[model samples]
Target: MEREFRICSECGKIMFEGYVIEGGWRYYCSDTCLEKNYTRDEFNEMYGDGDTETYYTEW
Candidate 1:
């Protein structure tokens, strides 16, 4: 992993030690940010390939 500072996909915040990553594609700093962007079901319906394991990104 590069371990670089990633910008939140939803709030545009800097994620330092903690961040939510979806399928190594998009990043979220928190659950609030994730939900604000897309609900789990909604996200799955669109971007997900039916595997929800990658959804547990909150640290």
Candidate 2:
């Protein structure tokens, strides 16, 4: 299978393919941009199985 790639919206750097839990495609060159867009606490509140512990990994 061929993974799609794109440029990061914040830095304009090359981004690799990855699965998005909320659905749809996403392109982020680094964790910085990802975190900037979807914060850890916010993401856990939405996609997480009510487990806030995993949110700590964002840092």
Which candidate tops TM-score? 1
Model 2: pairs clashing at backbone N, Cα or C within 3 Å: none
Using all chains and alpha carbons, the TM-scores for the candidates as numbered come to 0.49, 0.44
Identify the runs in model 2 with alpha carbons over 4 angstroms from their true place.
Answer: 1-3, 18-26, 49-59
- Model 2 lDDT per residue over 1-59, tens place: 75566555667775564324344344455567768787767666755774433222111
Cα shift from native, residue 10, model 1 (Å): 0.9
**How far out, in Å, is residue 31 in model 2?**
1.6
> Which TM-score value belongs to model 1?
0.49
List pairs with backbone clashes in candidate 1: none
lDDT of 1: 0.64
Model 2, residue 24: displacement in angstroms? Answer: 4.1
**Candidate 1 lDDT, tens digit per residue, 1-59?**
65667678877888764334455577877778878877777766654664653454333
lDDT score, residue 27, model 1? Answer: 80
Clashes of 2: 0
